[model samples]
Structure formats: structure tokens, C-alpha cells
Target: MRVGVDIEDGGLARITLRRADAGNAIDLAMARGLLDAARACAHGSVRAVLLTGEGRSFCVGGDLREFGALSGAALERHLMAVTDALHDALRTFAGIDAPLVAAVQGAVAGAGIGLAAAADVTLAADDASFTAAYTGVGYSPDAGVSWSLPRLIGPKRALDLLLTNRRVPAGEAAAIGLVTRVTSPDRLAAEARRTAESLRRGPTAAFGATRRLVAAGLSADLGPHLDSEARALAGLAVSDVGREGVAAFLGKRDPDFTGGAHRL
Candidate 1:
């Protein structure tokens, strides 16, 4: 399988891209594997998810070499199949309750950029670099790049990267809000694990609500957004998890939200 999934104790799920030989390139099989992994995470009781690559580079994008062999109708069919699977995976990852943390290293290009951008929190290794390779390859954006990029770094900056296809280094990427944190290469794995662990012990449903609210805010008008926020807040306030959190706050204790304890 081109994707590996490991669900650890305490509801932390780790998903790794496993095509190290090709910089974890997304082939049809990889896309299918990704979709399966994503579906597993969403369907399970995972509290947090960690996404990373298994080799030197995070992901170099699609398997263009595979594409190079096809032409005309064959190429069209192959492309559609790959995108169908990839889009399903992306959609599942974005809609799930578990917060996503991506630990990226080496090169992140094309669809890889979209994957990183979709993360709730992205951490980059010191040596990490990002590029938008679509235009250079005589293609347009896919893998949710067009939808996530502009929301991430603003439309103008997103356009500049898309049009120029320039490489953005780790530090610059963090400064531009492309990544949440940048750590030394030696410490990247440990830091990412620690971050996911911390989130695993948090209120999973609350984390999901915050993420969804932010997504909703992008397209919602002020009045409607306020109404939506009010409704969400009210819903959470009465939830079992919310009551436990309130009690914990009053008693100066840690809140526990495990095993559907948060439901009522």
C-alpha cells in the first residue's frame, strides 16, 4: 500500500505517505490507499491525526512518469480515476472531527502543497521547501490546491506562488502562514508527535467545531455567521463534554472527554 495507517493508544492516528522511492508520489494506488486511510480515520474514534511522509521528501506530487506513458482517452480515464479517489480522501480528511497535523520535510510540490495546506496545523522540517508545480507542467491546480491555498495565504500570495512556481523555504513558509511551525530537521518527528499527543488529550469535538466554524466563516456574511456561531456555541454549551469542561474549570482539574463521555 502506498499509504500506511497506525492508530496508537489514546486515539492518535498516524497516516504516512509511503512512496519514498518516488518522493511519495501520488499514483492511482496511492490515491486509493489514501482514501481508505482517510475513511478509516473518519469512521473510527480518533481524536487527532498525524500526517507525514516515509522518506527523504514529503511528496513530489503526482506520478507524472506514469502519466507520461498514457495518451488521449487512456490518459483522460487514468487522470479521472486518480482524481476521484484523491478528492474523496481530501474531502474526508477535511470533514473529520479529528484535528490534522502534518509534518512535512524535503520537497512539497503540486498536490502535496494542497495536502499540507489542508492540515489544521502543519509543521515543517528546517530543510522543507514548497512549490506549486502545476503551471510549469502545463496543467491547472487539483487536489484542492485552488480551494485551500487562497484561504491559507491570501489570494494574491497564493496566485504569486501558483503563477511563478517558485520554491518557498521552511522559514518563509511559516512567516507567510503556509505552515504553523518550523523545527530543526533532527527534532521534527519528536515535535510533531508531541503536538499530536497534546491534541489527543484535548476536547475532540470542540476542536472539530472550531475548525468547522473557521471554514464556515470564509463564505458566510457577518449576520449569518454570527447566527451560526451562536447556534454552535449553544449546542456545545449543553453537551456532556462542555459540562465536564466547565466543572473542571471551576474545580481546577483537567477535563476528560474520552469514550463518548462527551455525548449526552
Candidate 2:
């Protein structure tokens, strides 16, 4: 399998890119594998997901070699198929209630940047670097990179990266809002796992609501957004997880969100 998926007992799903030899580049098979993995997480009892790459680079981008093998309409069709699966995977991950965490290292470019930015929490190794390599290869963005980049780093910065394909080091990437934080390379895996585990123990339904709220707030007017928030909070307040959370808070103890009847 080009993608390795493991769901732990506490509902933490770990998705690893297994093509270490190719810098985890997204070939057609890997793209399909990713979609399968994302669907598994979405359909299972997963409460959180951690995405990581197995080797020196998180991902360099798509497999140009594979693309280079084709031409004319064949290339177009092949790329469409690859992006279709990859985009579906991204959508599936976003639609899931489970929060997604990504730990990126080494080179991150093109679709790799898209995958990292799509995560709710992106942790980058200090040595990691990011670049928008699409233009360099005479290709446009895919895997939602164009949409995510502007939202993440603003229009000017996003355009600059996309047009120039200049490399942004980890520190600069973090400062520019490309990643949530930066950690030492050695600590990337541990920190990502710890973060995912922490999220796994929280109220997943509330997390999902909050995620949707934030996404909606990006385009929603204040009055309607407030109404949405009110409705969401009111509904969650009566839920089993919410009740447990309140009771635990009043009792001065940690809440066991996983033990709730809803288990959401």
C-alpha cells in the first residue's frame, strides 16, 4: 500500500505516506490510496487523524515522471484522474468530524503544500521547506492549493509563492501562517502524535461544530454567524458529551468525552 492507515484504540487514526523512495510523491495509485485511507477514517470511529510522510521529504509534489510518460489528451486525462481522487480525499478529510493534524518535514511543494495546509493543525520540522512548484512545471494548482493558499497566507503572498516558486523555509513558513508551528525535526513525530491524542480525548462533536462554524464564519455575516453559533451551542449543550463536560467541570476533574453515550 502506498498509504498506511492505522486506527488506534482511542480513535486516533494515523495516515502515513509510504513512498519514501519517491519523496512520497502523489502518483495515481498513491492518490487513490489516499482517498481510500481518508474514507476509512471518515467511516470509522476515528476521532482524530495524524498525517505524516515516511522519509526525508513529506512530499515533493506529483509524480512528474509519471506525467512525463504521457502526452496530448492522454496526459490531461491522466492528471484529471489523479486530481479527482486527490481532491476527493481532501474533501473527505475536511468533512470528517475528526480534526486532522499534519507533521511535515523536508521538502513540501505543490500538492504537498495543499495537504499540509488542509490540516487543522500543521506542525513542520525546523528543517522543512515549502514551495509552490506548480508554475515551475508549467502546471496550475490542484488538490485545492490555489484555494487554500490565499486563505492561509493572503492573496499577495499566495500569488508570490505560486508565481515564483521560491522556497520558504520552516521559520518563514510559520511566520507567514503556512503552518501552525515549527518543532525540531526529531520532535515532529512525537509532537504530532501527542497533539492528535489530545484531540482524540476531547468532545469530537463539539470540535466538528466548531470547525464548521469557523469555516462558515469566513464568509458569513456577523448576525447570521452569531445565530448559527447560538444554535450549535444550544444543541451541544444538551448532548451527552456536553453534559459530561459540565458535570466534570463542576466536579473539578477531566472530562471523559469518549465514554459519553453518543461517542461523537
Candidate 3:
């Protein structure tokens, strides 16, 4: 399998891209595997998620070798098949309430960029590099790159990367808001895990509400956005976890967010 999924008793789900020899490239099998992993992790029991890649590189992108073997109609079919699985996986990850964390290293190109951007927090290794490889290969963006990239880095910067296909180093990526943080290569995995663990203790319902509010901001007017913010805050304030949080603050104690009484 090109993807690996592991869920621990503590509700931490780790998803790894496993096609090391192929630079963790996404082929049909890999896409399906990703879809399956996403489905499995989209559950109330999953408090947080960690996404990473095995071997020297995180992911070099789609399986070009497989793509090269196809004709016109065959190529079209393959593209649809691969995208169907990939888009579903992305949607599943986005729909889940848990915080998403990614630890990326080496070559993060093409769809790999989208994968990293989907994370609520992305920690890129110092040596990691990013590029939008689609245009170079006579293709357009996929895997939410078009949607997420512009939102993360602004339209102009996103266009620069996509049009030029220039490799953005880890430090530059962080500066441009493409990644949440940058860590030394040796510390990437450990740091990402720590981040995930911290988020796991958070109020899931509140987190979900926050995510929705931000997403809503994208297309909403100022008035509508403010309305959403007010509604979401008011709703969460009465939730069990929210109540505990407030009580803990006044009591000078740590709040145990049980993700209380919130259903997905």
C-alpha cells in the first residue's frame, strides 16, 4: 500500500505516505488508500490527525510514469479516477472536527503542496522544498492547490509559484505563510507529534466551529461574517466543554475539554 493509517488508543490518527521508492508519488492505489485512510479517521474517536511521508521525500506528486503510459481517452479516465479519490480524501479530512497537522520534508511538489496546505498546521523540515509542478507538466492544479494556495499565500504569490514553478525552500515557505512552522530535519516528526497531542486535548466542538467560521469568512460579507462569529461563539459558550473552560479559568485550574456533549 502507498498509504499507511494508524490510530492509537489516545485518538491520534497518523497517516503516512509510504511510496518511498517512488518518492511517495500518488498513483491510483495511493489515491484509494488515502481515501480509505481519510474515511477511517473521520470519526468522533479521532481527536487529532498527523500527516507525514516516509523515506527521503514527503511526496514528489502524482505518478508520472503511470501518466505517461496513457493515451487521450485513457489519460482522461485515469485523471478522473485519481482525482475522484483524492478530492474525496480531502473533503473527508476537511469535514472532520479534529485538528490536522502535517510534517513535511524533502520535495513537496504538485499535489503534495495541496496535502500540506490542507493541514491546520504544517511543519516543514528545514531542507524541504515546494513547487507547483502542474504547469511544467502541461496540467492544471488539483488536490485543492488552487483553492488553498491563494487563500494561504494570496493570489499574486500563489500565481508566481504556479507560473514559474520555482522551488520555495522551507524557510521561504514559512515566511510566505505556506507553512505554519519550520523545524530541523531531525525534530520534524517529534515536533509534529507534540503539536498534534496538544491539539487533541482541545474542545473539538469549538474547534469545529472555529474552522467553520474561517471557511465562512472566505465568501461572506463583513456583516454576515460577524453574524456567524456571534452565533458560533454564543453556541459554544454554553457547551459543556466551554462551560468547563470558563470555570477552570476562574478557578485557576487546568480545563479538561472532554469535547463535551458535542456530536459531529
Ranking by lDDT: 2, 3, 1
lDDT of 3 by residue, 124-180 (tens): 999999999999999999999999999999999999999999999999999999999
Task: List runs of model 3 lying over 4 Å from the truth.
Answer: 259-261
C-alpha local distance difference test of each model: 0.91, 0.93, 0.92
198-258: candidate 2 lDDT, tens digit per residue:
9999899888888889888988999999999999998889998789999999999999989
Q: How many residue pairs clash in each candidate?
A: 0, 0, 0
- Looking at model 3, the pairs that clash are none
Predicted candidate 1 versus true structure: per-residue lDDT over 1-264, tens digit per residue: 899999987789999999999999999999999999999898547889999998899999999999999999999999999999999999998888789999999999998998899899999999999999999989899999999889889999999999999999999999999999999989999999999998888888788778888999999999999998898788888987788889889999888877473421
Candidate 2 regions with alpha-carbon error over 4 angstroms: 260-264
Query: Which has the better lDDT: candidate 2, or candidate 3?
Result: 2
Q: Estimated TM-score per prediction?
A: 0.97, 0.97, 0.97
C-alpha lDDT of candidate 1 relative to the true structure? 0.91
RMSD of each: 1.2, 1.2, 1.1
Candidate 1 segments exceeding 4 Å error = 259-264
